[model samples]
Target chain A: MAKSNKPIVWSLFAGGGMIAAFVLPAMIFITGLAVPMGLLLENALAYDRMLALVGNPIGKLVLFGVIFLSLWHAAHRLRMTLHDLGIRSGRVAMLACYGVAGLASIAAAVVLLSI
Target chain B: MGEVMDRRPYVREMPKSWWLGQRRYTFYMVRELTCLFIGAYALVILVGLFRLSQGPVAYGAFVDALQGPFAIAFHLLALVFALFHTVTWFGLTPKAMPLRLGEKTVPGTAIIVAHYAVWFVVSATLLLVARA
Candidate 1:
């Protein structure tokens, strides 16, 4: 309810919406493609031909974006999880929950940018 | 130096709000806990991606790690949690984000049924594609 808690709450809402919108659809897309591609990639990599497929600009961008948003969403949800599990309580606990989520999102963002 | 101290609050009473709030409060807590697996499973996928991005060897190692007694046990646990998370989420979706048109409110059961229908379609499509 307080102003400080607003960003984290809004982030959680946005993250949830993003997961529903992006991650679920993307998952269906990727998994639908994975069966054939996984086999090809697995076999081709043995002969050093598949690296280029995974190393493309568009592929990398999509992969990194999905990973970042999905994980960020997960981090926020997991904080709620800890609270539900009775591991978090009180003001300090609330801060810790959002703090961990923020850090996790930042870490995922860094991973996306770097890789 | 002699002193006796009672750590408990001296008031001999439970707040009135506790009695009024217990049922809803407990239900809310359980609902939140049940929904947690959605996040947990997502984290597992994230870890898999991290490993995959590391390189072929790391990816292979991650795959290999999934094959064993512990992996089997955890996978089952994950499946159970995932199912619980999905069902509860679908159950609550209508309440959380109601779809209304003028005077008509969509039923929660309808939302849940639609969710399962979509999940089944998506899952089957993937399976079919995999076999193809």
Candidate 2:
């Protein structure tokens, strides 16, 4: 029998799920609601502060992990969700879902590095 | 051998709309659909990051765009979906990784509580640190 690559995808899915569960709510609340609505400091996400955050090596790593893993996790889940919705073309679904995620991950890496 | 050959196994076909018939199934679908919002929110952040890399003006424009009515609405919905994902994920943690303490399995409730505790601490830290 051929080796299955399910584990690799599943690991990323699980890790991403963990991050999404533990950290994403606060992130969304902060960036989406609080900052935009003036609930937090006036310049919580100002360009200079944000640039500084992304400029730091540790910040870059953290942002990369969150963006990369979350994308993979969502990709895998979306693939399954598509299947559940009766799109039975497995190969096509897999390619489309994972393809977007792969491209986005590369984009994230590049953008982070350039910063 | 002849009788065995004549017997066909029964196979039940699941209707595509099966999930719609039950509340639990619908909830499950909603839970799965959280990925859409999560994926979208990730892309939004990615765009913001890209803009930040471009320059201050570009990043400032991106931030300005986020405050518009449509952007605010999208984020509001995304926030709801994200919170839903968090709640469901924490609920399933115990089943995914049961704790065993020297052959005695820890109660699932305890495991769930621990997850919530960690989640709260992490969230508070992020909010506070980001605010500073």
Candidate 3:
């Protein structure tokens, strides 16, 4: 069998896509709409409470995972999508798309850690 | 020379707006665009993390901005895009792995149902965690 590292990254993209599909919509609804729209109380996201949430090690891990995986998923997906659009430059598209994901993953880590 | 070149079967390259013409092609384009929404969504969360690290003052403002009309509108649009992403992704899962059950291949409908079931569980977990 000819082994390829592509599987590893593809696995990440698949997992990330699953996580994003399952979790992100609700998260957006709650934080972006429900809480903000006053369907939920204001202090539902009070500064201290949110700080405490991010302060938790588990919380940090989940946040970081969500950010990292989702970005990588989008990066790989966009790379393939460009090909579908006949970009005709796989190497450059791969580098550009994955490069942003790599940098953003680092940034997400740094920010999550600092919190 | 011109006549000879013109005589050759001209392969028309796909137009940039080629997706707009067909329902299937438009859906494909929408699916691709949803990837960007997911990317943008991740950026939004990362920004929240950065703001939190900066301290309560910055984080408060981020939450404030999220409440604002523009942010709400963006998220509302994002919600639609995210749902599109979810459905399309799960729809393809069976093809991606083609799961088997004993001697029989698992049905794609079963795969999608399993995905939704797990999805509900995770969503419940997140809700519980938030409440806790």
Report the alpha-carbon TM-score of model 1 versus the true structure: 0.60
Rank order by DockQ, top first?
Answer: 2, 3, 1
lDDT of 1 at B112: 71
Q: Model 3, stretches more than 4 Å misplaced?
A: A1-4, A89-92, B1-10
Best by lDDT: 2
Question: How well is each residue in B1-132 modelled by candidate 2, as lDDT tens digits?
Answer: 445566689999999998999999999999999999899989999999999999988988988888898988989999899989998998998999999999899999999899899999999998888788
Candidate 3: TM-score?
0.87
Chain B vs. true chain B: TM-score per candidate: 0.64, 0.90, 0.89
Off by over 4 Å in 2: B1-10
* A54-111: candidate 2 lDDT, tens digit per residue: 9999999999999999899999999999999999999999999999999999999999
Which 10-residue span in candidate 3 chain B carries the lowest summed lDDT? B1-10
Lowest summed lDDT window (length 10), candidate 2 chain A: A35-44
Clashing pairs in 3: none
- Better model by DockQ, 1 or 3? 3
Q: How well is candidate 2 docked (DockQ)?
A: 0.85
Query: Which candidate wins on DockQ?
Result: 2
Q: Which TM-score value belongs to model 2?
A: 0.95
Which stretch of 10 consecutive residues in model 2 chain B shows the poorest summed lDDT?
B1-10
